[model samples]
Target: MGRWVLHLPVALPRRVDAVVLVVALRDSLGHVPALDFGEATVSAEDDQSRRTRVWCDARLGGGQRCELPLAHDGGCR
Candidate 1:
């Protein structure tokens, strides 16, 4: 197995109730029928700098994770 770290910076207009990181297999039909791996309630932090940090971890090729700042509208602004 290979080790890797993925970081994704997501900026949203509003904060969501929950953020999930998912890993799945996509077929030729472009359909993700199921999630090969899933993680929830990652890491969300507010630096008081108008930004929230959300992040998670998985195996190689699993997916990307990030930390985001909190916004006023429930979503990342």
Candidate 2:
């Protein structure tokens, strides 16, 4: 298995609430596998240094229009 990185933008209203990362993978057959943000150092900065890292299991899909859902853990299961 390989690893994939996903960066998401923090919403304004949700900034007050903690947000976890969600990584979704889709292929020609549609959504197959995905992962949630377990370990991260999320920050609310616009600079490159302030970025959250979301790890996902590769070999899922690298095709076009791959749906990626980003949300808090237990929020999207």
Q: Judged by TM-score, which candidate is best?
A: 2
lDDT of each: 0.32, 0.39
lDDT of 1 by residue, 1-77 (tens): 97564444444333453343222111232254342222223233453335333322222344542223222233321
Top model number, lDDT: 2
- What is candidate 2's CA lDDT for residue 41? 39
RMSD of 2: 10.0
For candidate 2, write residues 1-77 as lDDT tens digits: 99887665555434334332222222232333453333333456555486554422223445422123334343222
Off by over 4 Å in 2: 13-15, 20-33, 47-77
Q: In terms of TM-score, how similar is model 2 to the real structure? A: 0.29
The per-residue C-alpha lDDT of model 1 at residue 76 equals 27
lDDT of 2 at 35: 30
